[model samples]
Target: AQSVTQLDSQVPVFEEAPVELRCNYSSSVSVYLFWYVQYPNQGLQLLLKYLSGSTLVESINGFEAEFNKSQTSFHLRKPSVHISDTAEYFCAVSDQSNYGGSQGNLIFGKGTKLSVKP
Candidate 1:
C-alpha cells in the first residue's frame, strides 16, 4: 500500500519565524510527492511537488522541500514565515501506476497544523 505520513500534527510559531514540516512515505512502486496548504474555510492549494529530475522542489511562496529516495522522505522548509502562512498543511502521495491518464488518487497524511502568530 502507498501511504504518506506527516510527523507533526501541530506547529506553533510567532510571526516571521521559520518552520519545517516533516513527511515520509512507504510505497512499493514509484510515487509522486506533494505539499498542500489549506487556510481556514478554504480548499487546499498546491504548495509544491517533487515529480522528477530534482530532489529539491520549491513553492512560489518561499517554501522548499527535498525528496530523499533512499529514506522515502520529503520534508518542507521555509526560512521565514508570516502570519498569513497560518494554515493546515498536508503531504500526499500518488502511485505512478495509479496515474491512469489523469491526476491519480491522492493519499493524504493526517495533516500538520501550522500556526503563525503576530
Candidate 2:
C-alpha cells in the first residue's frame, strides 16, 4: 500500500520556537506529497504539497517541506513557530494518478501533535 509515516507523535515547543515534523513514505509507484495542519477542533488546512516541478514547497504561513525522492521522505519545518501553529500535523500521500485529480480519500499518518506554548 502507498502509505505515509510520521515518526514523531508530538512536538512541544514555546512560541517563536523552531520546529520540524518528520515523515517517511513507502510506495510501489510514484506519489504526491502533502502536509496538512489541523487546529484544535477544526478541519485541516493544506500546508503544502510537492507535485512535479520543485522538490521544496512552502505554505503562505512559513511552513516548508522538501521532497527527498532518494530517502522517500517529506519533512515539514518552520523556522519560527507561533502559538497559533499549535495543532495536529498530518503527512499524506496520494498515487501519482490522484495528484492533480480528485484527492480521493488521503492516506494519512497517525499525525504529529504540535503544541506551542505561550
Q: What overall lDDT goes with each candidate model?
A: 0.92, 0.90
The count of residue-pair clashes in candidate 1 stands at 0
Highest TM-score among the candidates is held by which one?
1
Worst 10 residues of 1 by lDDT: 95-104
**By lDDT, who's the top model here?**
1
Q: Write the per-residue lDDT of candidate 1 for residues 11-118, one digit (tens) a residue.
A: 999888889899999999889899999999999999998888989999889999999999999999999999889999999998777745218889999999999988
Candidate 2 TM-score to native: 0.93
lDDT of candidate 2 over 1-118, digit per residue (tens): 6888899998999999899999999989788889988988899888899888989999999999999999999999999999889899999988876645537667899999999998
lDDT of 2 at 94: 85
Q: For candidate 1, what is the TM-score?
A: 0.94
Clashing pairs for predicted structure model 1, backbone only: none
